[model samples]
Every structure is written in C-alpha cells, then in structure tokens.
Target chain A: MTLLIQVQLPDGGWAYILSIIFVSLQVSVTAVGVSTLVSLPVALLVGFTDFPGKRVVTAVINTGMGFPSVVVGLVVLILLSNSGPLGGFDLAFTPQAMMISQFILATPVITSVSLSAVESVEQSVRDAAFAMGGTDADVGLVVIKEARYGIVTAILAGFGRAISEVGSILIVGGNIVFSDGQSYTRTLTTAITVEARQGRYEIGLVLGAILLLLVLGVNGLGSWLRSKGRGERSA
Target chain B: MTLSAATVSVSYGPDTVLNDVSLGVEAGEVVTVVGPSGTGKTTLLRLLGMFRRPDDGTITWNDTDVWGLSETERLAVRRRISMVFQEPSLFNAPVAQNVTYGQRVREPWRERIRKSIRNLVGDRTLSESARDALDTVGLLDKADQNALSLSGGEAQRVAFARALAVDPEIVLLDEPSSNLDPRNTAVLEDAIRRARERGVGVVVATHDMNQAERISDRVGFIYDGKLVETGPPSQIFDTPNDSRTKQFVDGELMYDVEETTNGQARKSTSVSP
Candidate 1:
C-alpha cells in the first residue's frame, strides 16, 4: 500500500500524462480527418448512385464496420515491416504507422454510417431541387445539406471508434517514451495497458478515466446530433 | 418562346400513362390541363417541363428538340423553366433561402462556391429576387422563418415563390391548390395570375374544374391517356366538341368499370359537388 502511494504519479509526472494525451489526440484526430475526407464521398456515391455490384460493396462496408482491430494492426505491422513492400518508409512502430492503422479502423465506420445518413434524406428534397432546374451537382449539394446533422453524427461516431481503440494503435505505436521521459508515440489506451502491466494501477486508472471522458464526449455529441436531426425532421 | 410536346408517349411496363399526347404553350399564356386523377395530366406537364423524355416523341423548346440536345444543352434549357409539384417539398431552411433556391442553383459555379463560403460565414441577407418572390406570395414578413415551421398553405405559397424566383420563361404547376382552404386557394390563384401578367407561360394540372375556369385562358381536358379535347373555357365548359369533355365539365360520373375488381371499386377521381 505504501509503494502504491509512492508511485501514484508516473515517472515524468503531469507532463508525461499531458504528452501522452496530446499524442493520442494528435494521432486519433488526424486519422479521423483523413478518414472523413475519404469516407464522406464514398458514402455519397454509394448512397445516391446505381451501379453493378453495389449491394456487394455495401455489404463489404457493413462487414468492415465490425472488423477486428487487432487484425488491422497485424496487417499494418506486416505492411510496415522491414521485409514488407512499404519498408523503405521506415514507419513501423511510429505514430504515423499508428495513424494508418486507426484510419483503416475508422473509415468503414464513417462510410457505413454516413451512407445511412445520406440515404435518409427524403426523395422530395432531390425532386424539389430538380424541379427548380438544378443540375446533378446542385441536387447532390441540396441532399447533403438536408443530411448534414446525420453526417455529423457519423463523423463523431468515427472519432469515438478511433480514439477508444487500443489494439491497433498499440501494435503500431509500441507505446514508446523518449529518454527525457517525454512520450514518443504512447497514447492514452496503450499507456493504460503499459501502466497496468507494470503494476501501476494508479496511473492506469487515470488514463482510463481520460479515455472514458473523451469517448463519452463524442457519444454525447452524437446523441445531440441525432436528436437535432429528429427535431429538424419534425419541423 | 414556345414549349411543345409532339406525339409523346410514356409507359410503365404494360400500362401506358400517356399516349400520343401533344400540347403546346407560348409565353404569356395560362394553359390549364383539367382532368380526373390518373388521366396523364401530370405526365403531360412533366413532358412540357422537360423532367422526363418521351418514349416515342420529342419535346421542342423554341423549335429545338430538347431530348436531341446534349445533356449540357438540356440543362441550359431546363434553367429557362420551373415546376411546382403538388407536394410543396420545402427545404428545412428559412423561407428566404427556400425562395431563392432556384436562383442560387442557377448562379455560375464560381459564384455558387463563393456564396456558399459566404453563407458559412453568416451572410443571411435575402436577395432582391427572393424578396420580390416572397412579396408576390404575400409572405415577405415570414422570410426569416424556417420553412418547415410554416402552415401547409404557407409552405405551398413559398413553393410557388421558389418557382417564380428563377424568372423562368415557362412554369409548370401540378395540382397547386389541391389540398388548400379557400383563402389559401385564393392567394395561390392570385399568384398564378401575377405570374401570367409577367409574360411567363404557365401550365397547371388540376382536377378542380372551377379553378381551371377561373385561371385558364385555354383549357385542355385529358382522359384515359389521351388529350380528349382542348378549347377556350367558354367553349369547353358551355359548348363542347367531345361528349367526354361535356360529361367531365358538367360533373357527370365517369368510371372505367373494368378497373373495378374483387369487390374493391375504384373511387372516382373527378371532383364532385
């Protein structure tokens, strides 16, 4: 019990905690940003257009929404390994590699959810736009505007998934700290794993609390958006 | 300018919606298509509005075949026209925004992008045309209100304002007052009159024969996928060329007995006293 109290703080104190938090925010936010850029357009295309094998593509996205994170980490690890095709980039065990893993983890969630959002827009809105002499692009813009709240909810959901995930980022980031006791790639989730494994329950609990807060914030925003969408629809 | 559908036919599988229907509208005219429901009145308006291509004929805009033109050309031609569907289908936006939707979509791409960015930065000023359209509809005071919050009549009026805001050479309306109270119906009829005074050709499809008599300079009666007869309201209503037109204008019961099956009688689509 005395030892537990003695090591309540991590080796570098508050700066260490702040650094890992910053790293986690940095990596996860960037992954979500890239994922959104890729996912939104894909969702719109898949939702609005007709093509051969569309059902297959949608099924693939739905399948990917629940894809195992550790599997993604393993695939990313192999790709970034020295003997792999991308070995020249030297991204293995780096924050950039972790971002790649998280991005893969997040894209499907955003795409699948955003596709539903886009599809939820009433056909009447598109018809109205067309009746007003809007071109295809203009009609698409109007549909997107109507579906904005749901799309925002989708992005928030993606961010939640990326931030709370531990498996993929841990494998790619390696939870490393610099010699000066600054975090290199260690994130909140991986750091929690490390602290718990090292018998530092106090630090582990603190990291867990921060992660929970972030995830809760994201979920709250999603709930708010859903309600706002419902309210707007009612109006 | 003249918009005309020549020998146009539309089919849904084995069921024909319109067959060899020909109609034309010149600028500064109000041509109302009057008929019972499911008789291809809306289909004719759609063809004239260039919303769909005819299965067997051509739609000519200013003597040029609309379907023969390239898609870009078709879009350019489409900009010269507007349509108001039976459902108002208002956007969940401010009344001013809904009114100006047509004009905004018609802006040049660069201007559209700039305006979108400006809107994002809180530019909520109503455009001159939007203000004029709302004024015409007598809803200028409600410009800032969210369109979804408006009453049914008010929403339909806003839709009329949206169609007029574009200043199209031609406007098509599908059952514009089908579900309105008398006061709201009066406002809509007034707006239609105003649109005609501005030299914009108007085509309205309605089953309300009274509305047809009030607003039309000329009325065409459609029945069973065919243009049964067309003439001045005086001639079509008081004196008629076809027995079907006479039966319809006089409010006589007309039904396709074959359409009834299995103890389920098809309700008469004709407006009755």
Candidate 2:
C-alpha cells in the first residue's frame, strides 16, 4: 500500500502508469473495433435467417466464447513467431500481435451476445417492414436499428472481456522493456504481472486499480444501455 | 389489378390455419373479413398480399400466378402490394422514415450503400409522396417525431400513411381499428376510403362488426378457417345464410352456440379471444 501511494505521488511513476494505460487502451480498442465489425454482421445473419447447420455453427461459437484466454494467446504466439505461418507479417510481441490475439478472443463472445440482441428485436417489426414492400435487406436493417442499444451492450461486454483478461495478451505481447525503462509492448495487465513479480507491489496495485475502474466504467455503460433499450421497448 | 387467392391452404406445424379458402378483390373494391379471433382472417389477408405462399394452392396478381413465378417476380409483385398489421409495428425512427421505407429499400444503389443510407435519407428526402400520405392520414404535423413516441391510434395512422406512400395496388389491413376509439375508427375508415379512391383494393380483417359494415363493399364471414358466408353487409348482418355466421354477428363478443346430441335444445357460451 505504501508503494502504491509512492507510485501515484511521483511524476515519473505517474508517466509510467499513463503509458501502461495508453498501451492497454490501444490494444483493447483496436481489438473490439474489429470484433464489432466482423461479429455484428455474422450475428445478424445467424440470428435473422434460416440456414443449414445453424445449430452446429451456433454451438461452435458458444464453445469459442468459453475457450481459455491462455490457449488463444499461445496459438497467436505460435502464428506470429519468426518461423511460423504468419511470421511474414513480423508482428510477434508487437501491439499488432496483441490486437490480433484480442480480436480472435473477443469476436466469438461479441457474436454470441449480439445474436441474442438481434433476436430480441420484436418479430412484428420485421413483419411490418416486409409487409411494407421492404425487401430482404430492408427487414434486416429495420431489425438492426431497433436492436441498436442492445448491440451496444454486446460491444461493451466484448470490450470488458478484451480489457480484463491478462493471460493471452501477456503471452503474445511479451511485456517488452526498452533500455530507457520505457514500455514498448507492456499493457496495464502485463505490466501489473511484471511489477508484482519484481516486488514492485506499488505499480501492481496502481495498475490493478486502473483495470478495476475501466471494468466498472464499461459495465456501467452496459447497464445504462440496457435501460435505454428497455425504455425504447416500452415507448 | 385484381388480387385473388384460389383454394388456399395454410398450416403452421401441426395446426392448419387456413383451408382451401378462395377469395378475390378487384381494383376500387373494399373487402372486409369478419370473424372471431383465430378464424384465419389475418392468414387470408397475408395470402392475398403474397406475404407467404399457400401450402396447397395458388395466388395471382393480375393474370400472373404468384406461386408459379420466380422469386424475383414474386418480389416484384410484393412491391406493388402493402400490408398494415393489427399492431402498427412502426420502425424505431421518425415517421417520415417509416413512411418512405418502401421506396428507399428498392432503390438502384448497391446493397451495402442501401443498408447504411437507409436511415440517413428517406426516398430522396422524404419525398413529396410520403408527406402527402401523412397529410391524408392527419399525421403530416408529426412527420419528424420518433415513430415509437406516438399514441396507439396515431401510430396506426402513420402505418396507414406508410401503406399509401408506396402507391400500392392492394393494401391489406389486419384489424386496423380493433383497439381504437370511435373517433380514431372514423379516421381509419376515412383512410380506407381514400385508399379505395386511389383504385387500390383494400382488404381488412376485423372482429368489429360495425367497421366491416361501414367499410366493406363485400363482407366475408370466416369461421374455423373457412369463409362460411359472404355477401353485402346488410344481408350478412340482417339475415346471414349460416347459423354460425348469425351466431358470430349476433354476439358482439366471440360465442359458441351448440345443439344437444338429441337436437332439441341449444346452448350458448361466449369465448374470450
């Protein structure tokens, strides 16, 4: 606790804390942004239409949602390594590798949650849109519009998962340190792990507080969005 | 155009909702289907609108058999037909957008651009037709308001305006005024007349006997997924050909009249929809 207090009071320690936060946000935001773009359309397609093997695909997505973060990180680490299939991109231990790993981890969760969100839109709205001479595409748009807030909550859930989990990103990002003591690939979670290992409990405590605050802020936004969706449903 | 469903049959899972029912409506005609709840009035209207294929029959718009045509052709036929559900089910957007959705959906843009721009502009700036449609339904003043913010009756009127905006040849209404007060019902009736004036065949499904009488050029009495009787409103109300039809029209609420096995006495019970 004394170390945590010292880290916050010193200007240089504050800079260290801010740098970790910047790296964490960059990884999480890039990952979840890609996940949102890919997951929403896939979710809408799965949720709104009838197709063969739908149940199987849905089950696969559900399994992927529960897959461990460490396993994801290991697989991504292998792929981005110097001799691996994706090594041509030379992204090993870089922020781009972290983002790729996070996107892989977050997409299934976002897609599964977004499937429920899109399905929860009232069927009558689709019927009305179709009955209004709206083609196949139009009904899908109207449904997505009605489910916008719920989709936002799904996105926040994805962000929550991407930001809080430490195992996979740590494995892929390498927690690199520069000769000047600056962090290159160290995010708050990875940095917390390193600081705690080095007996610098103050940095770990500070980073833990930041992670908690971020998670709480994300969850608060989700709850607010849920209420907004319910309000519109009543309206 | 004359819209017709010939010997149509529809079933959902193990339950058969419509059975070999035939009906037709010519241009400038107002046809009303009156029945108790679950009598397949909505099903019949859906078939007429080409919203679904009949399980064991054929439907036609003009002289083209809708079921026999390719999917693109069926979609083309659907473009010329519009439906208004019992619940308004307006989009969660402005009234102008809801009214202009039909035209904006089928514009000449690529599919991706169509999806993104769908809410941005409504049929080239909420075109004159949408406003004129709103004016017809007394909702022109509420054009920019969020569609979901309106009262139930007002929302139905917006739906009415949306149906008219597309200039469809047939407008199907499934209980358009079932929950409305007399004043709102009168407004809906006026809208129906306007649709008919535009040479659009209007098919309405309702349990309200007065509305069927007030708006129908021909009244169809449906019972247990069958058109038990059909005629001018006076004949159906004053002296129905079928006893079931009489039992239905005589009781404002849904009621069943059964005879004893001995065929000597009659028992009557009202069923809530």
Candidate 3:
C-alpha cells in the first residue's frame, strides 16, 4: 500500500532539483554580470557622445538585439569546435562555452536598451548642470544617476534573455546525463528540453513551473525599482 | 573685477539671436536686459553664463578672455559664476544636495579629503551656508524634501538658493520671475538684492518692463538681435531715444509676442494642404 501511493517527480525531485537550479543561477548570473560590465561603457559612449558614423554603430547594435539564438548557437559551435579557429584550447561542450554563448546573447540586449534609457533623460538636465557650474564629468554622472532605474531594467531584460534560452546553451553545453545517475552540463532550460522529449510529463511541468517563477521574480523586482525611482521625484 | 561680453553674436542654425552685443557687469551692480519674447534674451544669458560659446567676440572676467583658458581652467572660472534659467531646473535629489551642487561637493579625491578636513574644523560651514541660502529664499522649512516636489515658483526659489550657496561672484537669471506669483516674485527680488549686497554682479533677462524698471541699475533694450538702446532705468523708461523701444514699452509693437494667437492661426493655416 505504501508503494502504491508513491509518485515519480523530476529526477525523483529535490536532490537533482536544487543542483539544476544552482547551475542555472550560476551561469545566468555570471553571464549577466559580465555582459553589464562590458555593455555599460558602450551604452554611455553611444548615448552621450557625438561623432562620425554614430548612426551606423547604433544600427548595428540595434540589429544585434534581434539576432536569433539558434543562429548564434550555430556560429559559436563552429568557432569552438575542433576544426574551428578557437579550438586550440578545446573549450567545446564545457560550462565555459555555455557562458560565452550566454554572454554574447545577453550583451546586445543590455546595451541597446540602456542606450535608449540614457538618451531619454531631458536635455535641460545637462544645461542645468552646466549652469550650476558643473563640469562635463559632473553632468555625465548626474545624467547616469538620473537614469539608474532604466539601466536596472536593461540588466533584468538581459538576464531574462540569457536564462530562458535553450538553443544556444544546448549546442555549446551538450546536455549530457552521466553514468553516475546525475545530469552533467544540464541547466533548468536544457533539462526541460530533455524531460519533455522523453515523455516525462510530470518532470517537464515541475521544471517549467520553476522557470516561470524565476522570470516572474525578476520582472517583479524591475517594476518595484522603477516605481521607487519615480516616487522620489513625485514625493 | 568686471565681467563683460564684447561684440557677442549667437545664431541658431539659420536665424541670428544676438548680434554684436556688448555689455559690462560691474561688482555690486544689477544689469537687466529687456526685450520682446524671442529677441534672444535667453541667448544673451546663456552666453554670459558660459553655457554656450558665442559665434563672434569674447567674454572676459577681470579682463581675461574666458575662452583663452584651457578647458580645466575654463571650468574653474565657471565655478565662480551661477545661472538660473526660466525653469526651476532642480535635480530629483533632496533640496540640500541641490543647494550644494555647485560648491565642488563631489570634488576630486584629493580635494575631497582636504574639504572634509575643512568641514571637520569649520563645524559644517557648508551645510550652514546652504541653510542660510534657503532661508534667504524662504525655503528653509522645506530643505529636506525632494526638490522636484516643490511648486513651480518654489522650485525656482530653490534654484536661486542653490546658486547662492555656491557664493558665486556673478548671478545670471533668465526670466526667473516670469511665471511666479507676486509673493514669490517679491521673494526672488529680495534674494537678488541680497546677492548684490554681497558684491555679486547680477545679469537678468526679462520681458516685464515694470520688473526690469523695478530692479535694474542699467536697462538694455534688444531688438532684432541688436542692443537698440541702453541707459539708466529712469532714462530708458521715461525718456527713450529709440522708437522701437517706445513701441515695445507701450505694448504697441506688432510681431512682439512669439506665441500670439495670430501667429498660431497663420501657422496652422499654412500647414493645411
């Protein structure tokens, strides 16, 4: 009777569940952190400075934002494969490859949105800073300080892009299940793919529920930050 | 020391704003520029405030051409002057930070350390000076509030207080009292008086003849991007030499108001297919 009441969960649930969650968090967070560090200066330079061919640079970045994940996966797989140019160090099918793929996918998402965010500030703010005897550096910092909420939103969007993707990470990570009865190179998104393909309906549902919750949590935090930013002025 | 703009000219793409304009502002004096809307009053103010470089001529403080200095040197010179625009233009921060903005509060690392020592010994002199500026503008009670939440005129007053907190040698105002009520206007004028009393030169651009008449030591009437006439307030108001100035002071100059209903009608009709 005790055996009759038993039910199967995702990899029998909790043991593998926490591991998978940790792997997903580690990869997405690292990708987002690196992406933000690289993209912030790009956003600032594009948003603030005037120079020749700025429109071309903006167009390229804007186009990159809509690049297909499958196409990015194909390109990265070729680059990291044995016959490809960057194969000397043998980085293929490793966590590092997944990180590089996610980083590339996340950067344009953060950069384009952050560029628009910085550009949306009122030009009068710059003039006022100058009038108050602020140097150019002071004015730049003031503008960035004012656009903090939008920059945060850009980060969240990039994280969402990196974490929810399967096409790129699968090609780069190989999604292998090891003989030790544990999944290696398996993230929540890639595990969902494996479970759904194997007709393991319950496991797929559980992993999917967690993924949705993570996305919801990030979006909720973004909205809260934006409202708090608005309240300071409206208060 | 005197701050003067000599033969200053400014243009906006195709249209000229100020042409061959020259003015000298002496310490302890209030020089007001009066003109119709769009005759480049704000442009003249921007040129004086170092917010814009003129198309021609030079601005000199104490007989040194401002643009002749290096960028860092120019910035140092700019720190000694403050400008208040028609808009309140306050940051979203608390009123205190807004007041302390132009005082090198966020100085270089080395300068900040020295400033911290000065603060420790002087017993918060900068904070007290900010409070004194707010008190002069009658916003001392609201010092801790977010500056953006103030009413339009109150925000402008906060801006004035912020300018004063810097202890600048010159104050440039661009129609600061145009949208203000009488009480707030009175408060602003009193603040201007205090700045002048501190031996600070004041340059104001305004359209209200009565306001210009009330506060000015010398009044320059600008017309068609040129200083058509300039004299003492009593002389310009009571005995003007230019017909254009008389027409303007008497409210008879056509095409004077930039946003007149007739202009709007013509604009709309012209845009119709």
Question: lDDT for every model?
Answer: 0.86, 0.83, 0.83
- Every model's DockQ, to 2 decimals? 0.57, 0.50, 0.55
For B1-273, candidate 1 gives per-residue lDDT tens digits of 999889888876776778898888989899999876777777788787776788898999988999999999999899899998888999878788899899888788899889879877988788887888899989999987789988999999999999999888999998899878899999999999998999999999888999999999999998877898988899889898998888887777354332210112222344344
Q: A153 in model 1: Cα distance from truth in Å?
A: 1.1
> What residue runs in model 1 are displaced by over 4 Å at the alpha carbon?
A1-7, A220-235, B117-122, B252-273
Where does candidate 2 stray beyond 4 Å?
A: A1-22, A50-63, A79-91, A178-184, A204-235, B110-126, B252-273
Model 3: per-residue lDDT, tens digit, B17-52?
A: 778999879988999998777677777777777776
Return the top candidate by DockQ.
Answer: 1
- Show the lowest summed lDDT stretch of 10 residues, model 1 chain B: B258-267
The candidate with the higher DockQ, 2 or 3, is: 3
Q: B184 in model 1: Cα distance from truth in Å?
A: 0.8
Among residues 3 or more apart in sequence or in different chains, the pairs in candidate 1 whose N, CA or C atoms overlap within 3 Å are none
Off by over 4 Å in 3: A1-15, A50-56, A88-90, A176-184, B104-106, B109-126, B255-273
For candidate 1, state the interface root-mean-square deviation in angstroms to 1 decimal: 1.9
Question: What would the per-residue lDDT of candidate 2 be over residues B62-169, giving only the tens digit for each residue?
Answer: 767898989888888898889888889888877887898886776765854765576555543567888889998898888877788899999999998998999888
Which whole-number lDDT from 0 to 100 does residue B251 have in model 1?
74
TM-score of model number 3: 0.87
TM-score of each: 0.91, 0.84, 0.87
